[model samples]
Target: MIPEDHFGSDAVATNRMHSAGVALEELLVTAQKQDCLTVGIYESAKLLIADPDSVVLCVLAVDNEEDVALQIHFTLLQAFCCDNGITILRVFGVRRLQRLLRGEGANRNLEEHGDFHCMLVTNPQADHCRLQEVDTYCQESRRMDQWIPELSLQER
Candidate 1:
């Protein structure tokens, strides 16, 4: 069996870079639907540690860099989510996640610098749009053991 420590290897990082774009579109859509989302590694980790039950899903944007440190960071975050029984999804590149989280028409000047590498989507209020849909999707996806995006033929 492959060892957990090997996730930081160049081979694994290269492999992850190749397949990382598959689910980005879907992840962006789901992220926009959440009204209660926490951005940045610190905020996301805090929610995961303090209130795992309230976190609906975690979407980590991995940097597709040659740096092994970045890979290790993502791996550790994924492992923590798994241990906490929280469903986590991963996509390559923090740019996509940062733009999506900024939301459409949001004032760029008012926003914090988009340096965060991960985000945690928490349970939304009842009045939020598509809250039920996202929640159901997260639960079903986790139960099915499907973490990566399953793109259709046209999406490829």
Candidate 2:
């Protein structure tokens, strides 16, 4: 696995490995607690435009091995989120996201179309602490003008 600092010191506020692990764990926990998490480009785009206030974070995956067009699409998504003041994080690929969403291990099989290029984490529930933590992380990241990591299709 790539070191957490490979992203940047701002990626995770804490230096502890467990804390970094907790960030991902907390994210999944928050996702499970709500119905606001949306997977897929179309659904995520709609959430970005129609309910910007509810969007907590936008996680983009480099899963499509097609061509640069897929990369362009993700760039556009990032621009949209940036313009809308939404926090965006680029992960390795769809498998990683699917694993998190499904609460499965690396050996688990991924369902077709279960792979999403963009996932919008929303806060429709409004009372969860984990979601609040996500929001806070995004807000702080924005304030520092730093992104967690920018994983490109070629990077995987």
Candidate 3:
């Protein structure tokens, strides 16, 4: 009982999601290479509090939606980002992102870096195209009434 327009809209949404994911992946990789990436919730929060202006983007990832503590942390982080005028994106698949950032078979130094729930891309010396792409996607999502658009990180 679905109308023809329903399928068309679904396809468009899928395309937009895919584009956002790719853009995010590219941004993360570039930030990592540039050494402008900050990992973990505590570390990112400290960085935000210490130097908010240096942060260009904040990405919150969640694999377990039932974690109340994590949810609260995200809420606080979102409010901070909003107040500071920093673009924030919600993504799923924290494990995938951890592997992507830390690399395969990397040592787990949770004590030093904390978990990979929140990541921040700090200011890079040079202009980045991926950053612009992500910003554009965020703006489009906001226009569509999505305050914090959710994206998925591809499994490699």
Best-matching candidate per TM-score: 3
- Candidate 1 lands at a TM-score of 0.56
Error at 82, model 3, angstroms: 0.2
Check candidate 3 and list the clashing pairs: none
Candidate 1 per-residue C-alpha lDDT over 4-108 given as tens digits, one digit per residue, 9 for 90 to 100: 678667576444433334334444445445345667776677777788877766676655657687667767878887787766665555665555556575435
- Residue 153 error for model 3, in Å? 2.5
Name every residue pair that clashes in candidate 1: none
- My TM-score estimates for the predictions, one after another, are 0.56, 0.63, 0.89
Candidates 1 and 3 compared: the better one by TM-score is 3
lDDT scores of the candidates, listed in order: 0.57, 0.62, 0.84
Q: State the lDDT at 93 in candidate 3.
A: 85
lDDT of candidate 2 over 20-83, digit per residue (tens): 3346445654665555567788777877878888887787776555668777778788888888
Report the C-alpha lDDT of model 3 over 59-148, residue by residue, as the tens digit.
Answer: 999988999999999999999999999999999988877667676433345324548899899985645548988888888888999899
Provide the lDDT at 28 for model 3: 85
